[model samples]
Target: MDKVQILRKISQIFFFIYFIFFTSFCLCFFGLIEKFILKGSFGSLVLKLVVIIVLTLLFGRVFCGWMCPFGFLMELSYKLRAKIYKLKKLPKVSEELHNKLIYFKYLVMILSLVLTYYLATYAFCKVCPIGFLTNLYGTVISLIILITFLIASFFLPMTFCRYFCPLGAFLSIFSIRPLFILKTNNNCVKCRLCEFKCPMQIKITENVNQKECIRCFECKSSCKKGGISFSIK
Candidate 1:
């Protein structure tokens, strides 16, 4: 492998480990803040908002590809799905449909923000499967949710990501100008490997700016012709 590939592989490994700790810390740290910090402090909420905005502005969906527990789980499910169903051979649809489905994430974002504004809570979190994954494991509801998620894994490729994940939705919109993104130059081979490998179903060549790209770099790794590149500006 070239130096770039080696570096990217290392980064992916680092992201996996860091995200495990990061999500755990965020869960626990925020829990402590909720327990100790006064709910009335508008400053606390403002501080968190600022942090999220800055992080999103700087990194884009790095958090989605690198830090989200749900994204992690979906990736895990992909492996298991491959083993049981051997779905790697399934035929793909037109690139146009793949691109169109990406907009669903934005709809989810709007719903989440509107709900948060009117109800003072994100409805997805109240029932998010990832929240269940991180927060509950052995309870009846957790077990039920787990079964539901596993079953969904059988039918849908990254079902929650394609359709219902609010966090993904949030990242999709907020990371419009991410610090890093995949850029295609005229290396000139439309092998379409990247399109097939992408978990989010993005048309990387035609729509690099699409909100659904999780920045997982799977496409870059799969491209054998060296036709694809990642850049930050």
Candidate 2:
């Protein structure tokens, strides 16, 4: 890995440790919003959410790339799958199918919020993988859901982030046109290495500012020709 990717990995590790041991609340945006809606109150949690939204507006989904503990676990699962299977290249969903599947996360976001509001309960949290990871839930359903998503991640890196995470869907609203974005320069040979390396499976050459981009900088680091760079949009 290049220096950028190495630094990103270290950041991910540091934040994952901090999240597990230092933080008390589940940082999942969906969960936080649900609680705020249910309680109809504002406090430190809402403040944190506001800060996250502002940061996302400026920097894209850096939390996913460098901070989210569950995202880190999913990435690990992807690497483990590659190692165990001795895969030369990770499998990728077709672009057409990928485009269609991305909408599912938005659907999840809407359904989860609406359901939580109408049902007067945090319905989605019962099955949220992050809740399971953070020991917020200990039921059989949570365990099953966590295992299912972990297996999906093993087969398709970032399957949850790409097509199922409500938090990602929520954050995408701000990240879609963040101030900073990945861009390609004249040096690009269209080798498509960056797209292959992107865990979110973003079509970097076509739309580097894609909402699904997690600001991981994998695309930048993977470009041996120095074709890709993160810069003001």
Candidate 3:
């Protein structure tokens, strides 16, 4: 394989192994408590947050695009969909609707926090598909919900991430205008191939550091003209 393909494969494998051996090993919360009540005890969640945010500031949404075990699972669903439907990737979503729907994740974050405050429990955890995906010893209802979310991914890539994931919302808050970002560097041929390849449906030709960008770096390889590159600001 070519260098770019090799690098991408290596990245995916490396991060997937990281997820299996580390994040899942820590029960998927990375030791973060869902409720504020548990904040008194020192937890790995704090250190984990610092590390993830620091890396995100340096490299842009590395957790969501690469290191997230759920993200890796969602990618597998896309591959299965392609094999069944005979398409390169999942269907292209409308830019207008996709943009609007993405905002829903923020609402989910707000509502989750609000409900947790009143309920004195991490109410969102009951609905958190990732929580269920990781803690398989939980309720049957949670398993059903996670299954539903996984099934939905076949129709819409990152269905939960783009619309309903509270954690994704939290990350995007810090990820807005990350110091490191993708850039065109004047090499773009305006072919729009990168746009088509972007899972976030971002108009890469028009904007590179878009908040919706998860920094998967797939678009970098899609640029046959070598237009895209990562840069630190």
Candidate 4:
């Protein structure tokens, strides 16, 4: 209801438009045109990859929070699951379990890198269900991708990003540095509102690294005590 929350909501909306609608649309259209009309060129593919990597470095995992089709799908699915199953009322996983699972993203990233190195392509992107959905053009493969997306959504909360999203994993390393992080002051009341607002289910108070944090500013907006602020160090 406050200005901060309003701004956060607006920012999220902008992210949805940029990442899901605009970027995905461009990538899908470009890929199709290159493969069919222009004939796939190695140069074009490499250029696209370079652009994505540069964006990641410049913005951290802002792409994950803002532009990733899978992230958007997960958020939408979370809302639906909350409505259908009343899951919003349920307590998040225990802190012990949550922290442990946080490492899963990094593990997935390493595995994905290995696979890409061996396969000479981003294997995860090649088979990403969300990416496939965004590019769906009537293919049996898309059907399989759809099924996978449904199953993941029904079972786990942001399961793809938590356990399988190699890009999320890739970003974790960059996020650990003392830069572009939400900092808290001593006035902190430990209200724990930030923890709840974090969609990644991170224990924001204890571990700031929180690989799952997308820098969405949800926690900063949620802090009623005005204890949280941004820092780049």
**RMSD of each predicted structure:** 4.8, 1.7, 2.9, 5.3
Model 3 poorest ten-residue lDDT run: 22-31
The TM-score obtained by model 2 is 0.93
Runs of candidate 2 with Cα error greater than 4 angstroms are: 85-88
**Candidate 3: misplaced stretches above 4 Å?**
1-24, 27-33, 41-44, 88-90
Query: C-alpha displacement of 221 in model 3, angstroms?
Result: 1.3
Task: Rate residue 218 of model 2 by lDDT.
Answer: 68
> How would you encode candidate 2's per-residue C-alpha lDDT over 138-196 as one tens digit per residue?
46787787788889999999888889988888899988888887788888999898887
lDDT score at residue 62, model 3, on the 0-100 scale: 70
Clashing pairs in 2: none
Model 2 lDDT on a 0 to 1 scale: 0.82
Model 4: lDDT equals 0.60
Q: Could you estimate the TM-score for every candidate?
A: 0.70, 0.93, 0.84, 0.70
* Best-fitting candidate, scored by lDDT: 2
Candidate 4, residues 70-101, lDDT tens digits: the string is: 56666677657766876533236777887687
> The CA-based lDDT of model 1 is what?
0.60
Q: Pick the candidate with the highest TM-score.
A: 2
